[model samples]
Target: MRPPYFIPADRTIDYQLRYFQAKQLHQAVVIDNNSRAVGLITLEDILEELVGAIQDEHDFA
Candidate 1:
């Protein structure tokens, strides 16, 4: 099983991307200041946030 990873809710998109790449993480649970899970995030989400949404051929225009 993969180890669990968490990211602060207030973190910047750039920082999050670097953290994910450094740790080789595809996704992680987002946490508030108190370490409560707020949501989930993925590398794809980070990339899309940086460069706008990514749509594949299967996606409708």
Candidate 2:
């Protein structure tokens, strides 16, 4: 497996989005101030946060 990309958790969503696009990364590991793996972030998550929730057929009630 490829090594995961790590990004600072303090970064803005816009910065992270650009970084992801530049590297063609779908997901990344979030690093906290202590350099610990604190969470995971995905391209979809960034888009959704920027544009609000996205709905698809799978979201049907």
Candidate 1 collision pairs: none
Which residue pairs show backbone clashes in model 2?
none
Backbone-clash count (model 1): 0
> Per-residue lDDT for 1-61 in model 1, tens only?
9989999999999999999999999999999999999999999899999999999786798
Residue 53 CA displacement from its true place in model 1, Å: 1.0
Q: How many residue pairs clash in each candidate?
A: 0, 0
Task: Pick out the ten consecutive residues of candidate 2 with the lowest summed lDDT.
Answer: 52-61
The CA root-mean-square deviation of candidate 2, after full C-alpha superposition on the true structure, stands at 1.6
Candidate closest to the true structure, highest TM-score: 1
For each candidate in turn, the TM-score is: 0.88, 0.86
